[model samples]
Target: MNLHGWIIYNGNLPGNKFLDFAQWIQAAATRKNSTTTIYKNNELLSYLGIGQLEVLRQDKNKLPDYVVFADKDIYLAKQLEYLGVPVFNSAEAIDISDDKIATYQRLAVKNLPIPRTIIAPKIFVSGQLDKTTVQLAMESLGFPMIIKESFGSFGEQVYLIYTEEELYKMVESLQGKAFMFQEFISSSYGNDLRLQVVGDEVVAAMKRSASDDFRANVTAGGTMTAYKPTQQEEKLAIAATQAIGADFAGIDLLFGPNNSPIVCEINSNAHIRNMFDCTNINVADYIIGYILNRLN
Candidate 1:
């Protein structure tokens, strides 16, 4: 448990949440009698064109025994992995989780439960969609559909389309970007479950519910309440995490009919601040413990 680790997070993001994640992990590692270094994603200069496997000019620093990657910088994650350092959640898992389209495809391939999703075709320009394609998505998903931009977080780019006009507008705005259409889980209108999965176990679980919007993100006015997950919920969450090749993730579950749980989304490097505040269970400890268990 005395291994040295690095916690990497996006420094460009305009909030304290990212830093808070890194600091919490650092603290947890300290508690475990381990040393940690926190680095912003940008601070590490990834050597690509220079034909080097290392990053940054400060190569004098010893390579970390393990890395807690909390950023979407896949190149940096992969570079560190290429050097044989263990990165929790892995680069591939983070890539798949960052793209909703890829995430659903992986889950479906594994025969896991997920909401019905239809991915929009790739486009280079923003404009009106061809009637045929729009009609297909509409007929397949129907009204009150969920249009989620492939690369977004915290439900900011996810929309609840209630009519044709709204759908078209949302689609037009996202025409050139990667997005998907999903059948709305009316049963989970404003409520969802978040199971923080660490190394095949559901360490902490919470129910997030919003009164104003369909999104159950705490930043979107959703309130988090500590909740115990059922056997089925835990199973699906653990399976979904593995489906994306992740050892750790925050798995969001939607309430499906007949008391079933559906995979809504996965956060490979899910922030633990909110969960810690809500559940009083620090996943940072779980993460450090999990990493130490694996490394040692």
Candidate 2:
């Protein structure tokens, strides 16, 4: 495959993890005989006008056949798409995956198994929180529920509220930000399944458990173990990936009643390093292969 591609990640984030993702994808592309260039999101200036769309990239390095978008910069990704470059996972997928409210809405529209959720209305300031909304969610989800901001990663913005006061405080504090109230799945306390799906198949998976936290994200001090997903798990994960219109994704599943699988979340740009460390599976290879095949 003599394909040329670009791997783009966020440059402002103060971590090598984003670069690691871009580099991993680059190496995988290289092994397949594809040439790739890694660029930060800030490197390319997206310009838009009436009947015009272009990025102020260097004239020497032309755009590639495709782009491996590893950042949450949906606007930049959409600009690339507008210029007719096929972007794996696509901008729309990333946009939906980045918003928990949108993710749940997509999942619910598919009639997928998700925890009962109520979206908090977005208010402009800190003091404008509607207690009626809180009352409704409290009545619906009950105590010890979960409150998650619509846009957060690694379990940092998720809260487990055991009382109405904490719930109100948390919800009010997230002014101007989208968030939701969810019924906590007690059966899956401290643990969940992360299935890496490439295209239409589940390629790798691991069980993540935290000793002291409700979230099972690896970035939140969660431990991992290789997991063999049940047929139900694989099917649900694949359906979720498709539901979000992603070429590939990492689907988090919570164990529901009687060990049933519930959709916890879907990560469009999920880092593969942790999954690889746990399962020794290089999901980048699968992603590159999938993109090449799609391009072909």
Candidate 3:
């Protein structure tokens, strides 16, 4: 059957990165004898009326057979699903993957290996944290730990706190934000693995490192090298993807004391351009092929 798809991405985000991803998917789908149109999340409006739910696009009213959701706009993704259009990675997967606290909770329930983490209590108004609570969290995770906001990307919202003053200051600055405290993986400092998994297979893998920064995100000035994942590494990456119910994902694995794999983070809408550059593999081909097969 000839397939049609929509590659949806965030339009408001600066730079061409998001649109670039959509175009890549569109090109891949076309190569596979399928047709796809790129749409920005803002271009499609979701409406609610008495006993009706609808999404209307300014240029087109036709919905595709499937949607390659490359945005973190969970509500729009869910709206598409509610309209009975199949969405890759699913809305729930994106929601869970977008929130670190939720992602870790799901992984922990599945017995996946992750860094020791403590979710900060939610505060509506910006304010200071309780001294006793901060003290207990510090005692449990120790100094020189990691502080990560729940909703972040490109390693932008992650921090390393050394002294109590630094920790408190960082926490205070993040007042009213959903964040977490984590045990820093000293063994994997400035290094981690990015394994792209599609349909239970590791299509491509790369090791990311940074000399000047602790975060291994390439967008954060890190470097990437093609990697051959170990059996355990591959297994864990795939398992972590499944744990979040994602059809595909980029799973970041940290090195444990003995080089054991520990999931650092999972990206449901992970960018594949870097993987292609490092591994010379177009993961888009694997992703398009997987979607076609599933639809067939």
Q: Which candidate should be chosen as best, given lDDT against the real structure?
A: 3
Go through the candidates in order and give the clash count of each: 0, 0, 0
Per-residue alpha-carbon lDDT of candidate 2 for residues 1-296, written as tens digits (9 for 90 to 100): 48899999999999799999999999999989999999999999999889877888775588899999999999999999989999987999999999989999999999999999998876765557777888999988898999988998887888899998888778767888888899999999999999999999999999999999888888989999999999999999999999999999999999999999999999999999999999999999999999999999
lDDT of 3 by residue, 214-246 (tens): 899999999999999999999999999999999
Task: Rank all candidate structures by their TM-score, best first, as comma-separated numbers.
Answer: 3, 2, 1
- Please give the lDDT score for candidate 2: 0.93
Better of 1 and 3 by TM-score: 3
Q: Local error of candidate 2 at 180, Å?
A: 0.6
Compared with the true structure, all predictions reach lDDT values of 0.91, 0.93, 0.94
What would the TM-scores of all predictions be? Answer: 0.96, 0.97, 0.98
Off by over 4 Å in 1: 49-51, 126-128
Kindly give the stretch of ten consecutive residues in candidate 2 with the minimal lDDT sum. Answer: 122-131
Q: Tell how far residue 216 is off in model 3, in angstroms.
A: 1.2
Name the top TM-score candidate: 3
